[model samples]
Target: MPTDHPAPSPRPRGWLSRFDTLRVKLFLAIAGANVVLVMTAYLIYSWSFDKGLVEYLNKADENRLQPMIVRLAEGYRQNGNWAWITEDRQRWQDLSREVLGTGRMPRRPGELAPTPPAQTPSDAQPHNPSPQAPPAGAPPSGPPAPNVPPTFTIDPRLLLLDPQRNLLAGPEGRTEQAVLKAIVVNEQVVGYLGYVPRLQMVASLERVFLAQQTRTFAAIALGMLAAVLLNAALIARWLSRRLRVLGDGTAAVAQGDYSVRLPTRGHDELAQLAEAFNHMATSLQAAQQARQQWIADIAHELRTPLATLRAEIEALQDGIRQPDTANLDSLAQEVSRLTRLVEDLRLLSLSDLGALDYRFAPLDLGRFVGHHLNDAASLSGTPLHVRTELEQGVEVRADGDRLDQVLNNLLQNTLRYSASPATLQVEVRRHDTEAQLTWEDTAPGVPPAALPRLTERLYRVDESRASASGGSGLGLAIAHAIIEGHGGRMQASASPLGGLRWDIWLPLNPEPANA
Candidate 1:
């Protein structure tokens, strides 16, 4: 039978992994560099320290050796022979201490300052005052210890010997070492100072001090690195924090929350990005509102025609109205209104889908305007007093039919909206590399606030006005789209003639002089 056992959970990460981010990585790199710096400093210090120590030992050796040789030869001259030092271990040991060690001894090793001789008590026992240990198996006296070495350091094992290589001072256990230096007195070699090679004196205190210096260097390096790590971490964390805010804002936007706005901090790249994002969000919100308004307006416009058609049909079927010419004409008018709205919408959709075929060709802009003016004489609409000043030889590349359609839409709007007997001015001017067309009319100018969005789709200057004037309110919008497709601009402003002004700019590469 299988037992019911719980599955094991994944292990938690170690503390080090918690800092495994860009911030920590940058800090670690600096820390590694600091460690290398510390090691290099230590190695360099050790080399210099050892070199200085050797120099000090060599100077001490050179300065101290001659004094010691002179003192030993003086002892020999006083005794008239080597017998005074060679036969006595105490004499040799005392002389060695005064020379190599810092302690004082008699100028002559065996001699002492004059003092009056005194008799000792009969019951007094003799005592050995020297520091050397008692003979091998002698009685264990109270706390006797071995003698201290002669030199200040442990490395130099000393032996004093005659010119004949006869040992005098050092321990017999170290008799096998070679002669390290010959003692010279007045250009004569009397004896030799045999020792192990002593290159430098590195005392316990100096070793401890060197170790402390190394630790100090390491500590300073670690401290400096820690400071850098903290600063770097803060910088990285700050950058990441700003980016996280941007990421969260973008996510909110994707979720259809356009109200989210980010704060711009410094004048850095991230700050500029935040500013752009806020602008984008504001635009998106405005566009969404516009989209909603467009839907409502379309529905309202379509309903008007649809309701009329339905009402007319119902009236005829219920025997309320006969199919007279008047009723039939009313049906035809509604059908026509519906047709115009559909066609306008179809044009807009086609333009949006980039499927509109434009047959572009070069045209004389001034002549084109003059011809359109003559053609407008046959069309019936609101009356206008028209004037024209056409600059000749203004050449431009455009679709002639589309350009004609744009001018017709503008003329129709002017005739429909302007008061009767409107003053109209149409002018074509060649300005450098572009053609400028201005159509300004008198009175009934568009409002200041409404001017900005005058070319927006389905927008009208007067909302309370009736649609009986025969326009889908997309004339200027369609014209604007066409101009944009032709790489031009179309805008409406308050005319200098105290009326609504439509300005159109078309790109032109000026007609050649020969033509």
Candidate 2:
């Protein structure tokens, strides 16, 4: 019977994926900037308009009334004739008429308009009929009122002054007009004028100004939007190029190629990111190579014993050989080989995980060297020859067992690889706060290329020889880890014996060294 299961849910999108569209982000940013810019611009425009409008109206008022008053005063001062005087009155009447017209004409196209004065003749005649009349209506008005002056033909509907401010000597009538006052000179009220301009005219101009402002704001907004989109595209393109490189590198690494490198050309954050990525790639490549080499070394090490065991068992099954001591020993050797491999793997794991514990103690260099020298001589089945170039009683402090393991590994390694009856040398010296131990063997030296990789795990110069000599391929690795764990430095160099030279460094203070 089949079991029921719920349908699999789709993966949810992250915030960066859902809301990070480049174009949309750019648009929103541009929009926010424009809002602030336009608000500030609008306030400036409104203030300017208010200030300019008031100044404009003041100039208009001065031009209209001040020039007329000046002319009347001058004419009266020059000549007392009513004709000269009346002529000035006619001009003032014309000014009032023009102001009441549909629009204020700007000085008749080419004329440089004049200004008004503060004082004028008070004896000027009235623009309307006399109120007293001549004795019981007296022949229906004196001299026909002189045909009422052509300047007065303008419509009264647009008159600037209301009835209360009116100075005209005429019959009473009701009409609505702007508030105005006439200047008094020599006891005569003449020349009406408005201080605050007509609201209708001001409102009309304001509407047009507002429309211009809107157009200007829109144009600026459009320009900013275009600039934002262009910048976003350029940035996104650059980022995408780097991302593509990273993706390709990832794919190459996945396919077991660790030699790929990323470009580091720019000084931007992306370049730093690329640098970090390249470093990671390089490290991974090294790790992968080491792992592969480890597997191959293990296989090669185990294959011989396995093949021998298989051959011996097969021979016995076919009755070609008896179950004798020789066959049992062969099987036991195979088991021992497998056990050694497992132990090396375990030790490496502990070292890598920083779980290897040590018991530290004071150690004497002279005594330690003598003991190990004798031990290596016996194990290699060759005469131990020691050439010492050192000062005695150089004492250092560290874990004795771990340090001995490091020395033993190097000693055994030299003996196994070096020719038999080789001479061994041990030297001890002190420099500043640190002590050094050097060991060399009189055997054929390693090649220049192999020297640098000698400390690498499972790396060997002669793999076939390593198997015949029963080496587990982890001796140098263990030595490296032990010395490093003790806060010391271990390095290999060319020896005067024409073989490998190993050096171990330990601080006399026994404190951990800075990496």
Candidate 3:
């Protein structure tokens, strides 16, 4: 014999398996939105901050270069030409360093030391030609004191250009995209000082500052993202918990447990759903109770006649009672009562299922009521006093046969339940858009509480008396159903005539336009 073995369960695929639940889906949706927003803000802030910082640096550089332009202009005025410093490259380098207050440039290996300029008349007293005595409180000024070292250094890229655009001094190959300042002397353009604009921050302090700010921004972005994800997770968890409760409740109902109810705490859609679910459960519970009661009532109703028939047959078989005419008549009556009860139940079943046939036609409401009352009184041979208050020409759309059945059931109930020599009153009239009919009888009244339930199937006020009088208890129920099928409603109330009252309302038939 082969050995039996269990197969292994399939494994879940990767990390995505954890995201299959509603909680994960909700969390991901919220977290994804937060991430996109945070990232976009970070990128935008970085771009704007970088551009603004560059513009700020460029403006500061322009302001600092203003004094340098003015000093160059003064030097040009004193020399009256550019040859004094241009011919001696060493002199030009010294002037540049002294004017801008920058550190001295380092010399390359094997490079000759720069020679001092020769004694030329133009070079004797450059940049200062004002030969006046110093005023009191004014510091002695021969050459202007060098400005404190600038925050930034640009000595290597700074250059002097003559009026014709020829490079006079400073580094070569850096004139492209250079910022230029005009050297104006005596309202005439003399030369230009230019420096290449910085493409990125090169100063150690500036680089450190930018890097620190960038790190701060990134940290803030990350902190915000983390907080948003936490909040998203909390919200998703809360929602999923509520949904799980709903799912459990629904499953309980499916399993025929109609008592499950969910908490309706908030005014959200979920709360509304819970309320609706509770309502459905309550209705199903009532329907289930009603179904049980209906089965019990049917069994009880059938057993009475069945037990009587069985006892009578057993008596005749044992010869304890002869099958004489009187005995046979009693059995026949029991059978008739049983047949009537079964037929009534069948009719009620058909009506409940909306399977009752109806042929609607316009009938005079007052005339119809009068005709039924006369037939019932004459045929029943009851000594009850009958009265009719009929409003002529009150027409309603109804099925004639069903309308007759409703009237006969009401008359029969009156005859069976009311005391002999009691008054039976019938009234028909038009009230607004409806045709209203009221049928009331005198004495042996039903209890107020039982009045509302009179039209319920197999309901009887005096069960023993109703049974003795051969009442099937389905007459009113069937009558109510037929009236409803004919687009009418029947209501039972405490009769002013001291018995039960039945009120029927039907829509009035519309008059023909040509009429």
Which segments of model 3 are wrong by more than 4 Å? 1-20, 44-207, 320-328, 511-515
Name model 1 segments beyond 4 Å from true.
Answer: 1-210, 510-515
User: Can you write out model 2's per-residue Cα lDDT over 61-83, one digit (the tens) per residue?
Assistant: 55655544454344444443223
Q: How would you encode candidate 3's per-residue C-alpha lDDT over 1-515 as one tens digit per residue?
A: 99989989776688967878899999999999989999999999988887788788778778777877876777677557776567757556655665555633444458654433344775355566667543211123344345455456666668889887788887887776777888888888888899877677656566677899899999999999999999999999999999999999999999999988889988999999999999999999988887898898889889999999999999999999999999999999899989988988988889989998888888898998888777777788879898889999998888899889888888888888889888999899899999999999999898888988899887788777866777878899999999888778899898888998889999998874234
lDDT-better candidate, 1 vs 3: 3
Per-residue accuracy of model 1 over 328-432 as CA lDDT, tens digit each: 999998998999888888888888898877997779899999999887966765466789999998988899999998999888887878777888899999888
1 or 2: which has the higher TM-score?
1
Residue pairs that clash (backbone atoms under 3 angstroms), model 2: 66-116, 66-117, 67-115, 67-116
> How many backbone overlaps does candidate 3 show?
0
Give the TM-scores of the predictions, in the order they appear.
Answer: 0.65, 0.61, 0.73
lDDT of 1: 0.75
Summed backbone clashes in each candidate are 0, 4, 0
TM-score of 2: 0.61
TM-score between model 1 and native: 0.65
Lowest lDDT sum, 10 consecutive residues, model 3, at 133-142
